[model samples]
Target: MGRLTGRQKLGWAVIAVLVFVYALFPVLSIFMTSLKSTSDIRSGTFLPPKVSWENYQQILTAEGGARDLFLPALRNSIGISLIATAIAVVLATLAAYGIARLDFRGKKLILTTALGVSIFPVISIVTPLFNLWRNIGLYDTWPGLIIPYLSLTLPISIWTLAAFFRQIPWELEQAAQVDGATPWQAFRKAIVPLAAPGVFTTALIAFFIAWNDFVYGISLTSTSAARPVPAALAFFTGASYFELPVGAISAASIIVTIPVVVLVVLFQRQIVSGLTQGAVKG
Candidate 1:
């Protein structure tokens, strides 16, 4: 890459701003809509004349409203996503280390197969998974959702961690052994620390994939017991036939989105390192 001229840099900056605005417009619109009352929403204003907390209150406190359902879905999302992420990261770490460090036949094939599986459309498996879960008594439960989420999270975790692992200098393990460290201790204290950023980044990615899932969540779950926030939001409605719970939906959407934003902000550096490391390698 070459350094850009002043005009070129200015042009790139403009493009970046435009892209940012394009992506941010919808989120801003949703926040603005969430703050509006029903009447203000009906008026179809981009920004509300005055902000009202009624929408949030209704969703949180009203009987037969989102609170009864939303809370469970939120819990389910958090629980399932965390569980899936933890499981995926642990398995991925081991698999990645093996792929990167150990010589074995079919290693490339395994990586390629995992890549293929990761890109497989979730919709294609929904019907079959539905039937399988029902037959196995996994339908409409947390396990149903969590099991399906593995199909998505696991592959990405393996791929990213493997890339990061490959970048590690294997000589450190030997160096630690020479220093009287046991194999397990050498790995735990040496490799683990060096790979922490990549592992943390993989965890974040896996969690996001699991948390933001809507297709599997909606397809596999029938009740609030296992439904996640994204899926539960579909069932929310206004009190009457003539009304819509747009404000409440927006508020709920914002609430769920906050966690993702916070997580990204907190782990941005690790995320960048993991992604770049993975991309730079095979």
Candidate 2:
């Protein structure tokens, strides 16, 4: 391909700037709101009059129950998301390997079903899951949330890992066996190394899915015991019903978003590799 002309470069630069603004606007607005005082928030200005850290401190150490509820909810979110991601990655890895390497009837059907389940509207199942969890005694517990998260995370994990697995050169496994390596040894030494990036990427995606969940978290758990941050944020308030907590909510949102940003920044390369592993023709 020929290099772009100056005019073409300028056009693309403008487009990039617009897209960046569109994506960054919401985050910037939230951060700015977090820096404002309650009176400034009532003024409804996008930029705060002055920087204030009191919103952060208020949520962290309020005399009332904000700190108690927020901290436990944060821990619940972290613990539940980690547990769901671990289980989803393990199960999806094994399932992807089988679907990629082994021949079986109805394989395509299985994949289609998983895809369908993943795309199914979560709201549609809330009523059923609510009743089911309450009946089985999984209600208001970590497993109550974690189990529903699997339904969301597992299908994506399987599809992504399967795509990556297909890109691996099967000849390497044969070569390992030719060198007198056992079947299990060949898989460990030859196959897993190539698949590690995909596994890591799947884990990240799974974690994000479970972490971002709100409907299940809210519908299933009545208290902070199993409620994630997103659901718990709904209960935040100022002094009373008349006093809304815009600043505190914004601060809490910014705090919750930091870990997701960190994870994406630190693992951008592996995420890209896993996503594009099988896209090209060899």
Candidate 3:
């Protein structure tokens, strides 16, 4: 490709700026809102009259009402999301390898079923799951949420990892086996290392899905025992029944958003490489 002319470069730069503003404007608005005092929120101004950390204090400090609500939910969100991501990545790696390497009956069916499950409406299944969980005594528990989360994360994990596995040359595994390594050793030592980018990318995607889930979190959990952050945000309250906890909610949102931003910033290269590797077959 030839170098761009000055005008082309300027045009591209303008478009990049526009895209950046469009993407980050909501986050910026939330940050500004988080800084506003409760009274200042009603002033209808985009920028706060005076910056206040009261909202952050309300959610983060033990003395505040929201602290109890936010802290447990934060813990649940982290623990459940990490557990679900780890399980999905491990299962997906094994399942995807089989699908990529073996010629089995119903392989297409498994792929199609996974795709279907991923797109299936969560609302449609929540009622049945709710009743079933109640009958089985799994309601309002971590396992209840984790089981449903697998349905969401597993399908896409399988698809992404399968495509990635297909791109990997099978000779590496054969070479390891020929060197006297057992099948398990060959896979663990040789194949797993090469699949790290794809696995990491899939785990991140799966965690995002589980973390952002609200429908399951709210519908299944009755208390903070298993409620994740998204669902717990709905329980935030103001000083009086007549008021809304807008600033507190905004602050909590910013806090939860920090982890996602940090993950992307730290693992951007792996994410990009994994995505492109799966897209193009060698």
Model 2, range 98-161, lDDT digits (tens) per residue? Answer: 8988899999998999999999999999999999999999999999999999999999999988
Put down candidate 3 lDDT per residue, 1-282, tens digits, no spaces.
999999999999999999999999999999999999999999899999999999999999857588988999999999999999999999999999999989999999999999999999999999999999999999999999999999999999999999999998999999999999999999899999999999999999999999999999999999989999999999999999999999999999999999999999999999999999998977
**Backbone clashes per model, in order?**
0, 0, 0
The TM-score values for the models, in the order shown, are 0.95, 0.96, 0.97
**Candidate 1, number of clashes:** 0
Which window of ten consecutive residues has the lowest lDDT sum in model 1?
273-282
- lDDT, candidates in the order shown: 0.91, 0.91, 0.95
Q: Which ten residues in a row are the worst by lDDT in model 2? A: 273-282
Candidate 2 accuracy as lDDT = 0.91
Compared with the true structure, the alpha-carbon lDDT of candidate 3 equals: 0.95
TM-score of candidate 3 against the unseen true structure: 0.97
Write the number of the candidate with greater lDDT, choosing between 1 and 2.
1
| Candidate 1 clashes between residue pairs 3 or more apart in a chain or in different chains | none
Best by TM-score: 3
